[model samples]
Target: MINKRINITQKNFLLFLYIVILGLFGPVVYWVSNHNTQLPFTGKAEKNPIQKRMSIGEKILVKANNDAAKQEGITAFAGGDYVLAIEKFQSALKRVRNDPETRIYLNNAIAATTESPFRIGVSVPIGGNLNVAQEILRGVAQSQDKINRNGGVGGKLMMVEIANDDNNPEVAQQVAQKFVRDQKILAVVGHNDSNASIAAAPIYQDGGLVMITPTSSAETLTAMGNHIFRATPSTRNLADTLANYAVNVAGSENVAMCVDSDSQVSVSFKENFTWAVYNYGGKIAPFDCDLAAADFSPEEIPSQAISLGADTLLLAPSVRKVKKALEIASDNDDRLTLLGNHSLNTYSTLKDGQNDVSGMVLSVPWYQKAIARNSFIVNAQEFWGGGVNWRTAMAYDATQTVSQAIASGAERQNLQQTLANPEFSTQGATSEISFLPSGDRNLQGGLVKIKPGKKSGTGYDFVPLNMDQIIEAAPKPSPKGATTNPRVKSK
Candidate 1:
């Protein structure tokens, strides 16, 4: 009985040990069966969830590092350190292969680092006619500041070295000559007046310097060929538009043309005005005045309009001179209707001679009130504060255009090409502008009539002419053998 009891105990102990071993190996056996493999349970297996989360965190850290490197690269490029910028950018690109912003920065850095043989210099008449030129420069400076703050043009800040011309043609020529001889300056912006621009044009062409005039309206400047460019519309275009409006819209068959003989703008105005008027089947009763003549004598101008029975007068004198001429003309005949250029459209006309210019018509390329609410105008105004002049908006547009072209991979030699193929148009305070093939801005010149105010004591009010009506009134030119103006003899 004692032996049998001991055997039972041993059997029970072995069974318990077998159960314990099976419990431990159960999970391992199941895993092995599921994976179609054998199990080795010597070491513990890791939980996959924890390992996967850790891997994800590591990937996020790498992306953050790449973004940081890219930002640093952009900073380096803007600071003019191209070598460091390129390395950092390349490193960042490895991490993020398809970033447009990164690609732009890289392009800019490359352009800056690469040495070019052509060096272009731009000049501005920052002084003289302090109101106009200063306003222009202020706009230019502000625009440049904005561009530099936004990482510059293709990573290179435009360094403009300004020299004052003092509004003197001789001084302008001398300054231009200096820039040409330096070989670093490839272009000039100034000689604000036509006389100054014309004087410096030969020098610029001879020196291979591109002369871009912002204000000169000389007819001869455009004839200088590709070397010269002007941002302002030619007086010729303005004059033609005015003449068409006068003969067709105003219904004036006979017109008296008066021009300041001494002024280049006046010369251009006379030439274009005469051509456009004659082509439109209107007879011109001519009168020319020496703009420098101080006297207000009508004999000095010697108008043939009165003798020829013309009731309408086309006045192409300076704003100040026009006021004098109008005052003189009013005394002679109050019935004479007056027509003028955009120069006469000013606050001074309203302030100085409200009665004299009460019923006159003029053509202008831009109107300030038309674009006063544009965001660019608002931001530019805010940025410039009281320093913003109405004309500065045009300057801002010009500068922005140049910067954008450069940023778009325009080489120095290919500026004209880039300008010709401008991919963008900017809204300025005065006008929305894009360049045409002739470098003339694609803008509409409109007629505005100065009319007496409804209130007896109030100043004259400006009324915009009906553009559609004006277009319809003008005689359609025959496509086949249209009568063309006789070309004026070039001096």
Candidate 2:
């Protein structure tokens, strides 16, 4: 009986041990089974809100197109092996020399491996407009490389974190918030579109962070806040430059305007151009066409303009309507003087239009040949393997502005105050940079005309149009209603 009772006691003890073991390990096993794809739930495994939105180190490589060397470099970077990261990034760059993002990563890795670095965030449309994004990034990367090579900002190297906003307003706001949350990021140089910049401006303003936009030029951005600054010339300035040239220099009296009604930038440019044209003793033609119209016919624009007694065609298409603008340019077939805003200053104008766009005058924010700083051009050529456009120039200027402000004071509030100061000024790729009370740059834009040239690599180039060239290209006075009946196919 004693042996039997002992056996029962042992069986009960074994059963209790099994229950305790199951209680402790069952949930873990279940969790492991359910979450096979995820890491174990440690506090370190949890991604922060910033990580969810923005890519960094190895994370960026995953999101972007990747190669073996770049992947290794990013892995090393994520693992805190800065030396390996730098070496691998350099190796990767040797294979793909024209990639701006890899160059930037290499520069950042170099900065990190060498010294303590100050960081800034650059938000761009990496997914939506990869080429444009790279152009902007080339400017930022060039500025960073130059600054680092020249002993950096008081011996602390500058590092940049790239954020892909994809030019979406919602994504831009998210990126802005992420940037504002990170205390290490001193300032931001970013947001390619006016709407994107506008969406993110309020967030940056509320957070007291300095946001310098390289390309956005909407008038609404002018008054967003003291913290928001624009490196590019205001829309009114660009429009006025084009209008003055059209009327006074080009001797155009009657201009037929093609506008994209769906785009704020287009409408704003047209309105400002109209005001400036009327003030300069020129009149807008009565017949106007909307580029954004669903049934808009580019082939008929030229014939209609001729019928309405227009001596010049002003294209105010948005970035989305560039193809339409180019189609109109082809349809015009050199019958009338062509003028466009900065929106049309794209490679498409040179490649797609070719001879069709010759002699077309465009208002641009900066021209490389016209800039006083030859060093910027030389360094850019060496760094990027080619010439860059106004976007690059303006982006470089924006980064220079922030670096100057950071030199005055690295703290966010102090830097904002420094940029807002009336005495603040810095020399940039575009010339001297100074801000008005409205946070708009006190600068004028340049005008360029497309011409056949061997240097452009596209059989055409945008030659800078000086005042003399503008006057020389002016057409002789012709009859107001002179119509050349070009063949038009009705849509």
Candidate 3:
């Protein structure tokens, strides 16, 4: 009986061991079987030709969860069967709607099947601000579609590929390196932030590649290099427009300022606006507030400004500090005229500061209502299912500028020269496109005032201010020896 029990116990123990081993290794075996890239037993990843072409992170991002159709499409593209590549890419997109890489591949494949094709890189912060990234991409996509449909630039179709820099300076440098290495990519369209642009400008200059920024407005970028160009107006242009309106038109020459010190564009805007204000016969108030400071008191700043003889409160916050700027606006409560740099022209302000920021003015590079490019507007709305913003317009202009340069048969060696030539001019979404010696756009900024409206779907809209509104908002002396602008306040 003791022998029988020992045999049974051994059998049971062996069965339990087998079950535990199966539980531990079942998923591993399944994964190895499912993934063709894994060697059966060596436990090493074997990259295919397409995976081998990508960086490790890029391979993970692209192929880790990538569908079979996308893999097939990539293979077809590598094989130079552009028609098959396009078909496979389109099929892949139907399943993965928001895959920017797939969209870029599709665009490139379509361009390849055309008579003659040229490639450009559209670099943006796809991982950081997806909305801004998509906005810029829409502009490029629209321009590509329009140009190709209208017979392209001198019969050469423009193909675009998306590069996600994630808005980090280090990543932007990496992207710039990659772009410079790809000799086929003659021009690049972005690096949206000023810091990112500044970080990558030298790489582009060294590589003899042309890089045009659609939204970066730092003054430093103006002198970076001849290879660098800006489609958007500089900080100086934005400041001049706002300062002129505040000093000459609105009679709010004595301005108190709130600045974000952490942002390059914000600090640049503050310096330029200060000089412009003094030039326009205005003075910066002594009580300047730093929005980025940990001890920032939005509520206290306004009352102090009013007490210190400031009739205008300039909110020069960066994109990161717009919330604090809006807080200052709300706390001010119609006591002083509110004005801000282009950074404040955000959907957040329109939505969150509905009544508080109603009468506040913001400087922007482009506004669709101000410029009546009806065809571009109508087609963009039809394609994007809504209206686009200044970023989109500037991006369209940048893409158009590159297309024109490419159309002139300018390759990497001569593209910068072609763009910098005095006679190089092309029509853009905002206006005529041309580069100055500093590579800044020959453009001015426009001012828009927030007003109660349903157009923005936020119970308010950024209405382009007319001359009458700008000139008629000068403050009058109140009975209590205070300045008041009843005309500029929301009712």
Give me the candidate number with maximum TM-score. 2
CA error at residue 30 for candidate 1, angstroms: 99
lDDT of 3 by residue, 1-491 (tens): 99999999999999999999999999899888888552322312253222232321122124332787777777788778878888887888788665545665677788788776877887887666666677787778778778887778787777776777767788888678777877778899997888789999999999899999999998888687899999999998898788878887778858998988877888788877877777666788888699889898888998999999999999987666788999999999899999988878777889888899988888899887645657778877666666778888889899989888878888888999999999999998857999888899998868989889887799999888764455356443234422322122321
lDDT tens readout by residue for model 1, 45-64: 14222122111011221222
Which regions of candidate 3 are displaced past 4 Å?
A: 1-105, 114-116, 370-373, 467-491
Candidate ordering by lDDT (highest first): 2, 3, 1
Q: For residue 261, what is the lDDT in candidate 2? A: 88
Per TM-score, what order, best first? 2, 3, 1
- For candidate 3, what is the TM-score? 0.77
What are the lDDT scores of the predictions, listed in order? 0.60, 0.82, 0.79
List model 2 lDDT by residue over 89-198, tens digit each: 88887787767777778878877876678899998888777667888888888888888888788888888888888778888987887788787888999888787899
What is the alpha-carbon lDDT for the whole of candidate 2?
A: 0.82
Could you tell me which residue pairs clash in candidate 3?
none
**Candidate 3 or 1, higher lDDT:** 3
How does model 1 fare in lDDT?
Answer: 0.60
Instruction: Go through the candidates in order and give the clash count of each.
Output: 4, 0, 0
lDDT of 3: 0.79
